[model samples]
Target: MGGVNTVNGMTGIIMLVLWALAFGATAFALIHALRQRSDAFTAVDKLTKPIWSGILAVALLLLLLSFGGLGLLAFISIIATGIYLADVRPKVDEVQRGPRW
Candidate 1:
């Protein structure tokens, strides 16, 4: 019984860590997205800056909805943030470079 309790406690801790990491990653993307120029998004052929901001906002909302702690809502947050970082961030960087050599 003690061993079972320990395992359950460890699982909760792991979930907490995962949630924190996911939230941190989403916040990072949101800030970086905000600091970028609106025109840069167009040049990169990604969604407009306002739209991406909305997406990030929704991701944040999902995170909040996960107040019960990492669940389906939390996974949605991670997926939303992951999309922005993986698909959009690189494009934004390229556009900001203004025709790099």
Candidate 2:
């Protein structure tokens, strides 16, 4: 029983960390998407600015309602956030800032 409680506690902590990270990441992506020029996304050949903004907004909303658990909604939210950060962000930044030599 004590071991089970310990395991549950650890799981709870992990879930909380995941939840915070997901929320923060989604928020950051949304803010970044909003800050960039709409043309930058087009220049990068990515989704339109409004579409990305809407996606990140929905991801953030899902994260907020995930109850600190890594449910399907949370998983989807994290995936969307990851895509924005990993794939879209770099290309958008490059379009705005130019390539690094």
lDDT of 1 by residue, 45-91 (tens): 88999999988988988987785478888888889899999999998
Choose the strongest candidate by TM-score: 2
lDDT of candidate 1?
Answer: 0.88
Superposing all C-alpha atoms, what RMSD in Å does each candidate have to the true structure?
1.3, 0.9
Cα displacement (Å) at residue 13, model 2 = 0.8
lDDT of 2: 0.92
Candidate 2 collision pairs: none
| Model 2 Cα lDDT, one tens digit per residue, 1-101 | 89999999999999899799889888999999999999999998899999999999999888878878989999999999999999999999988898789
| TM-scores of the models, in the order given | 0.92, 0.95
lDDT of each prediction vs. the true structure?
A: 0.88, 0.92
Q: After superposition, how far is residue 98 of candidate 1 from its true place, in Å?
A: 3.2
